[model samples]
Target chain A: MMLPGFPDAAPLAGLGGGILIGLAAALMLLGAGRIAGVSGIASRALGISDSGMSKSSAWMFIIGLPLGAFIVAVWSGGLDAKFAGTGALIAAGLLVGIGTRLGSGCTSGHGVCGVSRLSQRSVVATVTFMAAGIATVAIMNAMGLEVLQ
Target chain B: MIARYLPPLLSGTLFGGGLALGGMTNPARVRGFLDIFGNWDPTLAFVMGGAVIVMAIAWRIQARLAHPLFAPKFALPTRTDLTPKLIGGSALFGIGWGVAGLCPGPAVAALVIEPASAATFVAAMIAGMGIVRLIEKD
Candidate 1:
């Protein structure tokens, strides 16, 4: 189904995808006894950070992320996506890396896993990010800066 | 050894598939969701809602289990303190996310979907993480 203002929005796909993500996270939590926080895993894998999970385990999970995407691509016939310019991508990436590490989580860790478990910090983090994201978009639009192509 | 790695591999695959199907890997769609005051899309809300509902059930199951299926003990966060660092960092992350509409999960997944762009973002993000690691040590 399409959203009111957004013609390209795919609610069914979003819901289906979300359920898959939830199941994956739940599997991680129940099977591995850990949170599927990508940034934490990535850092640990890269030797930049050391969390409780072993680096090998971290690498295993990290590898799975792209592999999973590949399966979907083959099944669904790939995505037609565009990215920001190199400079913008680099700038944004740097912020995301630092911010997620400092904040202790991101969309999956905080938004999906945290809120579901009713963790106060996760809830607060999720709200803060949402608010900030909205404000940033608003300001950028006002300035007539189209970051996305 | 296989058990140690297999679960996460499967989970990661599922997670990646979800990101792609949900359109989270698409930067424009993500930016559109962030554009709350503009032509906002509620699709992300549905994605979050679906995942949260399933995860809520998982939490309940987690509470009942003695230990995880493949692990000795649950390795989850226990900190509850609200700190300036947390808020400030999250705010920074939000801005970055808004600017590029890509986060760690989608960015990693995008490595295969859109190699060059994803690689660029990943490399920069890792550098940023390295810088933070240095700052924390000092």
Candidate 2:
């Protein structure tokens, strides 16, 4: 199952990592008064021009996320990317920015938060957005769009 | 005995393993997948599908709980409007995923292995959230 994306492994790790985050977010919401929404916290901080306490906590959440895998890597090891080039990374970032903007939430928000709550709307958003994501990758692949060497 | 936190832990580990197995854990793999119309890696759907299967389980179990582990009930978003924020953010997310193959959770998680750029991706993502939150004005 994992072999499919042999060349890259981060997203595979990411999927596993994302589940933890989602579960944590769900538990955070269920156990605490928080919403488990990163944007909400970041947005609030951005509002005050202050990444304040919440901002720090949010960072901790994001930062600590990899700590698990980091711990795993400490004992074992991990793979690395050669980079298709700078242009490619930049373009990819821009595309994600657009998706986050359009999706009203990131994968975490919609995929985790929205979907967890069993929101019908979130259901549509997740399906639609994810489908679009698939399509985007397909198109990019078909175009033979390569990172400028 | 104290198995309450077990579910999250187990689920999380499985999720991580899924990522590692699917290659979603790697940024470059994501880029290649998104290099659509070119590389057009369809492996992503499998990753998403597998994760969604877990997601479905989470949803089902959610109903069984008398009360969620944290909140009185599931904390679904109150905002229902398909405001520009919704559509626009999604579009931006799609484009970024298509181009860079970096998404929020994984990008942050990717920080562990590929320290440099993953950090940058996360920073921009955080900044984007901050900026949007500010302009929305409550």
Q: Highest DockQ: give the candidate number.
A: 1
What is the clash tally of candidate 1?
Answer: 0
lDDT of 2 by residue, A1-149 (tens): 34564543334544554454555554555444344444444343344334222454444444444655565555456655433355555555545543464455666667666775666656666766666666766765667675423
TM-score of chain B of each: 0.97, 0.75
**Best prediction by TM-score:** 1
CAPRI tier for the interface of model 2: acceptable
Candidate 1 residue B132 C-alpha distance from true site, Å: 1.1
Q: What ranges in model 2 sit over 4 Å off?
A: A1-60, A82-102, A112-118, A131-144, B1-22, B32-42, B64-66, B70-74
lDDT of 1 by residue, B60-136 (tens): 99999999999899989999999988898899899889889899999999999999999999998999889899999
Per-residue lDDT value at B58 in model 1? 98
After superposition, candidate 1 runs with Cα above 4 Å error? A3-5
Give interface RMSD, every candidate, in order. 0.9, 5.0
Docking class of 1: high
| Fnat of candidates, each listed | 0.84, 0.30
